[model samples]
Target chain A: MSVTYLEAIREAQTKLLREDERVFIYGQDIAGKFGGAFKATKGLAEKFPGRVLNTPISEDAMIGTAIGAALEGMRPIVEMQFADFSSIALNQILNNAGTHYYRTNVPVPITVRLPSGGTKGSGPFHSQSMEGLYSHYPGVVVMTPATVEDAYTMLIDAVAIDDPVVYCEHKYLYYHLKADALPKESFPVGKARIVRPGRDLTIVTYSAMVHEALAVAGELQRDGFEIEVVDLRTVKPLDTQTVLASVARTGRLLAVGEAFPWGGVTAEVISRVTTEGFQLLDAAPARINAKDTPIPYHPNLWSEHRPNRKSIATKARQILQE
Target chain B: MLQTAQRGKKSKKTAPEKPASKKGQVHERYVEAFRWMLTARILEDKLASLYRGGMIVGGVYLGRGQEAVSAACGIFLKKGDVFGPLIRDQAGRSAFGEPLLDVVRTYLGSVKGPMRGRDGNIHRGRPRENELAMISHLGAMIPVMVGKLLAKRMKGEKEFVGLTTLGEGGMQTGASHEGLNIAAVEQVPLVVVVTNNHWAYSTPNEREFACANLVDRAIGYGYEGHKIDGTDLNQCLEVIETAVKRARAGRPPQLVVAEVLRLAGHGEHDDASYVPQEMKAQPFAQDPVARTEKYILENGLLDEDKLKQMRAEIAKQVDEAVATAQQEDPPYPREEDWRSMSTDELIDKPSF
Candidate 1:
């Protein structure tokens, strides 16, 4: 049976609840039969009993309470119904949880699961990639898992790390992406994976955009140009070494992300390459992101707003010709 | 003490009657709470002097008039219970078992303090001991305390309650609303004490909330509400002690709203010229330290000679803490680790 990305997330929570007494799941409508907004916590609430509990519709309190629980030696997994709503809890998440360890010697081991990125018509409020936003803060590990194996293992790893973690699981890939079975082991978090190897140019991306980059790599293969793809499993600790190595081999770089265009993950990747690996580039490095506007509701407008295979391929072709 | 027109307005809600059987135990608690309140008052006075003398680096906030309520919030908590104290909670912190050295060392920027010179002033806490070092955001600590109680429950621990304090202004925040609702929904044994000191920084009660009283929010949020005149140590001890006991007995979360007027400016920097002199003459403006002292002497809780001895001992302890903290070195930039994340291996080193 094929394990989907969403199923893998459920399995990880199941394993955590079974093994660790300190681990508990707290979120809105995630208990009893309601499960969660996306059912990522389905069946587990019954399976774990009191360990998986529902919470009030208070995002600020959700994160603040998780931080408190973490302080009291509990590893809480908080699920934001959508990535967009996490903005309401920024004070608790960024200031309280983010600054707690630095202010005190104690670590806060809380995992905030943000169902991130755009679905076809999820609209401005629901469809947002917040990894870039959360990554800007210190004391938080931002994980944007692109595959089923990484989704399961990275989540488990996120809980083990003694700091706040923002796990940005792409809403679009929840059911669409699948694997043969959950892997016994996976690559360590905060490392990049070379999904496709090439020598002509390197495409650096993460989350749902990894699939788009791979599709562009396949399209460019028929055009007699080799394209490399690097999936940044975790964006904050950002495996810069892997990206630099890819750039050294390919001699060109293009960072792609689904977040808005203004200074996010894509911009950070380009900034690092230009500052450190400037000599590795045959031409100036480039990046592609969603238009600098709120994500639209119409399918056509939404398609144009975010980076996709068609746009990535066109950008790749132009870079190869450069 | 001068009584204003507003003094007897809320007198209808009188102090709970002291039980005849528990008179000695109640008297002993009164003496202990009084000692803590005195220590906090003296320590804050020193801090204020330090701020004025330019020995201290940050703002100095005194729990000048709110000590009666603040001490009561802390004195009732047990070893396992959590206490989240805000800016004006020094008395509560002392009663909750916070070391005076921790307070002095943090203010003096000594590296040996609990904050280790990373955070200074009121943002100091020993979390392992369940004393939450509060962030400056008002009402933010409420949810954190709720979470702590929830964790204890999940661990199958019993009879432990968590308490947190906020000002009249903080009670209006969305964080406070959410935190209160969740505590009731989970039925966690939590006590929230809102000391309405008639001002939040510079904002008055009228600007802070529209409710007749802050305690009015308790019933709507499914809490057992209690209100008291904060200046009366007897009323504060009676009301807060009852709220804590009710929570420990598995009742709904308890809300204790104590009313007092801020006896000093928001901080040492402002002279508080904006406060109307008429409002200052109100009975709620009675200094809790002086009032508690009078209660102890008048009721013979402690004789005058013994009270004097207690005050002298507390002063000596405060002096030693301040001197020791002053002698200690502040954190040096070169020696500072400067790392925020606890997971050391995850930090990226410059590969180039």
Candidate 2:
């Protein structure tokens, strides 16, 4: 059966519900036949009656309750309608849930599903990439699943984790990325997957940017210069060893992401590589991120605003020449 | 100790008339409530001492004047009920089943304690022991308790109810509004108590909100609103018990804005110069602890000797707890622990 990225997420949740009686899904309009805002939880409510709950339109309450349930030993997966709206519950997520484990030695096993990244005309209030912001905290685990397989596997892993996990699943990849079937067993979380192997330069990216990086690599392959692309499955427990090892081989680095440039995942990756593996790099590590502006409403402005294959390939060429 | 009269600054508005409580029969249950309140007072008095003596590095917050409200709620909540106890609810926490040693170890920042020396004294609770811990963000715990109660009900724990506390000043926060609104919409078995102490730090009742009483806001959320005398332990328990029963019966959530008095400064730091002298004496004049003591004496439940014995025994317990906590080492999170403690043991199973 052909599996879409969104379908894989649903399937993974289905598996979790069937396997663990403690697992449940909670969100606004995610119950009964309506599925969810994005239909990420379609059909499961029928299968798991009381487990799939539709909460009131209160983001703070949704997250706060999920944390309380997690503390009570129930695994709750909360779906924030839009990634941008997650700011409403930041106090509960960043302060309460994140600090609970460290402060009280009680693990809050909650997976907050954030439908992240920009979509055409999604505007500032609907579109955001918040993995970097959550990763800045001490106790949160940030997971960005790039592929359908990773989406399926990583979600299950997130619920199994003892700490609160911010699962930043890209909105763009929900239907676009597809695979023949879900992985029976996936790689352990926090390990970067090398999408393409090359010697010219290493492009470290995650989520939607992984696809763009791969596309850039394919286009550059015609010129006989091999490009390496690494997909970070999880951002917080970043696979620095993989990034450094790839950079060690390529000697050139280009970190890319769809998030804002200021203090973002791209900045974090570049900072680590430059500071820790300074001698391994032949040139200064560079990164391509979205312009430091709120995501606009128009498709043209949005297209130019984020880092695409065109901008990434151009930056790669400049860094290769250097 | 500061004289009772000098506790809080008096407000321009006069205190509400005391509720006509049941006259002079202290039941066994009321005696237990008094004991909890007394324990809380003794513990807080020790905490203040530790703060003054430099034994406690963090600031001390006590529910000195509001023990009746806290102990009443704590005593009424049954086994399946989940509660989020605030900084001023140690009596509630104790009554909710948290051991006295856990309280001492938490405040002392003992390395061998449940908190592992990570959090301060007031931020401690053992959820594993059925007590939900609270953070400094006031009104944040209201919704958390709602969620906990929802989970419990969904898991077939049908008799489960929830209790959460907030101050009058904290009632203005968006989290509190959102939490109460959802609890009403969902018809969750939740009881939210707003301790209307008439001041949000230095801001008085008039400046705190335009509403006549904080409990009236419950009307906007479509729930039954209550404004009870927080100083009367018997009246407070009777009101809360009805709400608790209504909640357990799957009725809509209840909003209780209990009028209490903040007997001490917000923390050990503030001397409460902002509170009017008249307002400060009001709580002392209507002190719940003293009132309960009077009830026990008038009803022949206990004489002065018995009360003194109870106080002395609690003092000994507090002293021993402090002694044990002091011998324990302070928490020191090493570099290795920081690096290795990235994820929990459950997720990091295959540790490659």
- RMSD per model, one decimal: 4.2, 6.4
TM per candidate:
0.96, 0.93
Q: What C-alpha lDDT, on a 0 to 100 scale, does residue A313 get in candidate 2?
A: 94
Candidate 1 structure, TM-score to reference:
0.96
Q: Which residue segments of model 2 deviate by more than 4 Å?
A: B1-26, B281-285, B339-352
List of clashing residue pairs for candidate 2: B8-B280, B9-B275, B9-B276, B10-B276, B10-B277, B10-B278, B10-B279
**Would you give the TM-score of chain B in model 2?**
0.87
Choose the strongest candidate by DockQ. 1
Q: Residue by residue across B248-320, what tens digits does model 1's lDDT show? A: 9777788888889888889888788888889889988888889889888888888989988998999999999
Instruction: Give the per-residue Cα lDDT of candidate 2 at A280.
Output: 91
Worst lDDT 10-window in candidate 1 chain A: A131-140
**Per-model CA lDDT versus the true structure:** 0.89, 0.83
